[model samples]
Target: MTSPSQILLVFPVGECGGAESVFMAIARHLDRSRFEPAAWFLRTGPLVEEVRTLGVNVFLHPITRLSDPVNFWRTVKAGRRLIIDAHIRLVLSSLGYGHLYGGIAAHQAGVDAVWWQHGIASPMNLIDQLAVSIPAKMIITSSRVAARAHVEVFGMNGIRLEVIHPGVEIAPDHPDRVASRQVVLDELGIQPGKVVIAAISRLQPGKGQDIFIRSASSALRRYPQVMFLLVGSEMFGMDRGYELRLKRLAVDLGIEDKIVFTGFRRDVPRLLEAIDIFVHPATAPESFGLSVVEAMAAGKPVIVTDVGGPRETVIDGQTGLIVQPNNEQQLSEAIETLLANAQLREQLGRSARDYAGAHFSQRTMIEKVEAALHSVLEADTATKAQRHEEGR
Candidate 1:
């Protein structure tokens, strides 16, 4: 058997967010015969255990601030040691601290590094910019729009930015929609026979769950059978206090009984099966739309804001509908349209399942990642060979 190359995945946080899940999926699907993956984390969270389940070594070196020299240097030094001792050939980093330490450590160990960009137009600090300039070999973004944003940030004269759409798991067999709907509705105290429309995302300011509530209220008046499920968790409940604001708005709108808040969930596929329509009303541009694609994978007709990554994922009319963001009237109309017409919903939902399965399978994502890594390694080798020839 050929020896596997060790790749170090340095994650900044342990949160089970979109970017983190993509990286974990990469690790899980990476060809073990040719590549071995391990991970290093800045702090621990629910995802740490999940990453460990991939049979990869994971280390946590937490730091509160960029200026924390003790932890920062200690972690960097540790990264160097890890690179050397574990024979790490490449490192992939996400987030601020991960880029800082992972880039520095890769340079220290004389290995290749790739930066994974997740946030949309979220500017990097001077220090992170410097780290990318010096040590990072490439950047991986989930969408072409995101790639363009990073290129502008990086001042792209010759920067290599690869747009790799994160993959989703296509369920082998569709979940039992009737049973799932019954269970989820019963648990959330949503009376049976009510139409379920859900926004499955983190409860953050940019996510626009508050906006969703406004539209849902409008839709509720038009179609009283509609109930909204807000399925997500607040990161320490700190979305500019948006969740509380949403509750207040719901009560004021007199649609409090029509809403259910299920904080953070593991049964995403089941939840997707349960919901009749998937709505993502992001007020801000998203770097990528994982949930939107995942919903499509679940064979659910989706509605997304006509901005950012969803533009790339959903074919507007073929798979799902796209409405202008923050427009309550438009959002409500889209919701009502889907709820009113079962034929349209079924047509879109079936196309969505086929599209997701063909385009976003987990194996395809893994292969793309592996190819990108190999390209960098091969380029490095060619450069070294050229340098040696010149010296001779």
Candidate 2:
């Protein structure tokens, strides 16, 4: 058997967020017989140490500011050297900034680059243009919405663009929902008989915590037995004190005590088991609704915004409800609809669990990613052979 090809995974930040989770999954679960993966983190944080435990050589080359041209080129050179020294055959980068850093290095070292777009479907800016300038072996997006938008923006023939949903683990055996719910409720001092609705994401402006709070306020006005849980804390210094703003908003709406802000809990699946409903109220479009999928996997019915990945993943009146982005009235109605009807909640949750298991399992994601990597190398070999034949 041939030796495993060395692959370098590049990331913009080494934090445990949605994108970082996908990065970790790949590093941990990739077939060791075929590929040996290493990681290069642009900024240091918690995940760097965790990645080291996976037996992957982790390199920290911090890029504190994106605008610093000197630092940018310096890290690119460092990464290129690593790529060359390690004999990296392929470089996989997360998001656009990572593409800029890793893509350029891969090009310098004469290897294939594959970029995973983990954000919304939006018009490409100058930086985005530069990031995509380095032709990739394949561009994998988290959702079809993202892939189509990127295919148009990158002006590709859609041959190299692929849609691979980021995966979440679906435990075959779940903790008793009643017990889990009581544990969370008891810990938080939330009384029994209250239906819990949760919105989980990093505490950032466009993530729509304010919107969720307002909807919760409206829903709670009619239904007194419902409690709102806003899970997650400010991550990567991106908060801009948005968490405080959300809290103040909750207070202003007179629903402060009705809501619980469970900032940054690692027990998301357990928390999902504790909640009756899930909401993803992103004001900006999401490339893939990872939390939404996680909730579904945990057998919780979700209410997600209509303009992005969540809309694609959730079926209205089937798996879950899809409200218009930033629409408080619609969101409030959806929340109240589920709160008022336990049968609908259970029905939607069952369907969502089935759909999530079929589509977004960790095994499915790793297998798809593995196949994509193989295809990239295969295409590269084929191209080299074709060139050799032409020369002959």
Best by TM-score: 2
Candidate 1 — which pairs collide?
none
What does candidate 1's lDDT look like per residue over 1-392, in tens digits? Answer: 66888899988888877888888887888888878999988777888888888799988766666777787788889889988999998999875457788988999999988888776654645654655565677878889898877767766646587888898999876346687679977888878887789999989878889889999988887788888899998873255567788889999999898899898898888788778899999989897899999999988999999879999899988999999988988999999999889999999999999999998887788889999988988898799999999999
Which number leads on lDDT?
A: 2
Clashing pairs counted in every model: 0, 0
TM-score for each predicted model, relative to the true structure: 0.94, 0.96
lDDT of 2 by residue, 51-116 (tens): 999999999999967788999899999999999999999999998889999999999999999999
What's the C-alpha lDDT at position 141 in model 1?
Answer: 84
